[model samples]
Every structure is written in structure tokens, then in C-alpha cells.
Target: MRILISLCLALGGLLSLPAFALSDSGQQALGQLQTRWAEIRYELPEKQREAAFAGLAKEADQALASEPKAAELLIWRGIILSTWAGAKGGLGALDLVKQARASLEQALAMDPKALDGSAYTSLGSLYYQVPGWPIGFGDDEKAEAMLKQALALNPKGIDPNYFYGDYLLRQKRYAEARAALETALQAPDRPGRELADKGRREEARALLAEVRKKLE
Candidate 1:
């Protein structure tokens, strides 16, 4: 269950950059992707969400095509593809996860600090969420390294804190996980992300409650 939750990290709204600062087309692309992300995470039924995310993946591809070297665009595209892979599920989604990883790697190469280090967050989540053997390329060590870098880059961002907390929880580092989640709960809200912020805060609260119980 926790793995499933972690796979849907896109719902946490990792893109912390203000939309107003983006180019008009970039803003529009992000807006569209976020809307589809919300629909996949909240509104759509489990069976239908995969198709919804597939459509969003196409949109993300178009955005990346227009701004091939834009780190911001690459980050968003990675987010979309990651969410799409989560929705698709099973071994069939392996390719999508790989694509997401590649997109994030490109974004990192172009600008590791773009969108508040969101590419690292997303890539780290993918590394931990996918299978580790013949099935996929997951690596807990790599995930931890990447997530720590993300947190270092964006210590106060809700997404990084929550993700690191989730990673710690999965590793049974309950005390550290609880602390990270608590920090995530205290993160300030972004101007245009009220819905995403509210949703993520609720998730953090719930996870923190679970960690508290475990610590007890």
C-alpha cells in the first residue's frame, strides 16, 4: 500500500516554481499536466485513470518537443510519465518508468536545480518504487542518495520532505520518517497549488499518524 502511494508521487506537486515566472506556453503546459495529474490521482476511477494518464503523457511529450532543452519542461514530462507508469501498473509499465527516468536524467543534466530539484525527487521515487531484479531497475541505495540530494536542494519543499519521509518509513527508520513528515506538514503553501498542497498535507498527516503509532 505504501509502495502504491509512493508511486503516485506526482500527486504531491513537486514542481515548486511559480507559474507566473514561466513562459506563457510553459505555464499552459504545466497547468494542463497538473489538471490531468489531479484527475488521475483523485477524480478518475482506477480503471480509467491509466487512459487519462496516457493522454497526459502525450501532452507532456508535446511540451518537451517544443522545449527540448528546457529543464523545466523535462521535469514536468518526467512527472507526467512517472504518474502514467504508476497508473498503468504491472510489468507492462516498465517501459514508461524507464522513459520517466530518462526524462529526469536529461533534466538533471541540463539543470539539476530546476523546479527546486524536482527531477531528483521524481527519479528517486521511481528508483525505489520499481522492481529491483529481472523485472525493473529499482535500487534502494540509489533512491536514498538521490532523495537526500533532493532534500538538500529543497529542504523546505513539501514534496521532498514527504518523499524522504516515505522512503525512511519503508526502510523502517520510523523516528527519522516521523521527523521528515512533521517537517512536510509545516511546509508553506504555494500560491497556485492550494488543492495539491491540501491533498499532500493530508497524506503527510495520515502517514505521520501511522509512523507515530509504529514508534509507540
Candidate 2:
């Protein structure tokens, strides 16, 4: 009887092992997909951005359905939707924005600290971009709060820093914007490295030049 019980326990463990391995594999694949998505977004031509993001959004949707509670998948979905909305333009974009916000909110509710507050960063940027009317959607105060929460979670994250810096620059808070942009520029992550080194380099340099002009 003792030997039989031991064998049963061992068999149970073996049965469960595959599930654990599969979950780990799924998580790793999601991470790789995210990295690739970010890299391609920066490298791809402007005209191609929409189609690329749509493809990613479809993948993310399938992944989310497969792992309903996966915070990472939800975050990726939100990112893709937000990008899609941005690419398409006009009020038609609001539907995608709302979808992105819902997904991010679900992600945050599932795990507030997931992905180093990535959900918060995405939500913050979304709010910052929306207009502040009854239907428009922008809220500067909420954007600032969310961005600050993200920074608290991961001070080195590039998205929060870059978006917040852009907000400050728009507000003509040059000093603060410069500090935030510089921090974003110095981030060690893939998104930061790609943005600062590629698409945004010229823009950032021009902004810095403008700052110097204002100072002089």
C-alpha cells in the first residue's frame, strides 16, 4: 500500500509537470513577441505601421483568449489597439482607444505590478492623448498621476518617461521636459534604445535645440 501511494503521488507530479512547462513556454513566447513587436514598430516605415500593428493585435487577441488571465497578453493587446487607433486617426480611433483602456484596466486589476507597471504607463499615455470634453477623453491630471505611478513601479521604463516628457514639453515646462526626455533617452531597455537611437533622435535633438534657443 505504501509503495502504491508513493507511485500515485509521483504520477500526479509528472502529470502536472507538462502544464507548468507549457505555461512557462507561453510566457517566454509572449515576451519574445513583445520585443519583436517593439523593434519592428520603430524600424518599419510609417505607411506600414498600421498593418503591422493590426497583425500584432490579432495575435494578441488570440493569445489573450488562450490565457484569459494573462496580464502580459492583455497589456500587449492594449498597446496594439492604442497604436492602431493612433495610426488610423480621427474620432474613429476612439473605439480602439476605449478597447485599449479596457484591456489595460483589466490587466492592472489582475496584477497592479505586472510588467513593471506597464499597464499604467499605457493607460497614462492614452489618457494624455484623449481630449478633455464630455466626449473627447483627455485628462492631464489623470495622465500625470498614472505616469507617476508607473515611474514609481519602474523608474527606468521608457514609455512613461517619454510620454510624460512629451506632455511637459507641450505644457512648455521645458526644464522638466528636458529632465524626463533625458531620462528616457538614457533608458537601457529595447524600446528606449530603439526610439532614442532611431525614430526619435532627430526629433529629440530638435527639441533640445529649441530648449537651448529658449534659454539663450
- Report the number of the highest-TM-score candidate: 1
Candidate 1 lDDT, 1-216, residue by residue in tens: 123423766423335453324577876887777766766777678889788888888888888777677777777788877877787776677888888899899889887887788888898888888888677899999999999998888898898899889989989999999999999999988766676777788889989999999999
lDDT of each: 0.80, 0.66
The list of candidate 1 runs beyond 4 A from truth reads: 1-6, 11-22
Backbone clashes, candidate 1? 0
Candidate closest to the true structure, highest lDDT = 1
Q: How far is candidate 2 from the true structure (C-alpha RMSD, Å)?
A: 14.4
TM-score of each: 0.90, 0.79
Which whole-number lDDT from 0 to 100 does residue 90 have in model 2? 70
Which pairs of residues have clashing backbones in candidate 2? 130-138, 131-138
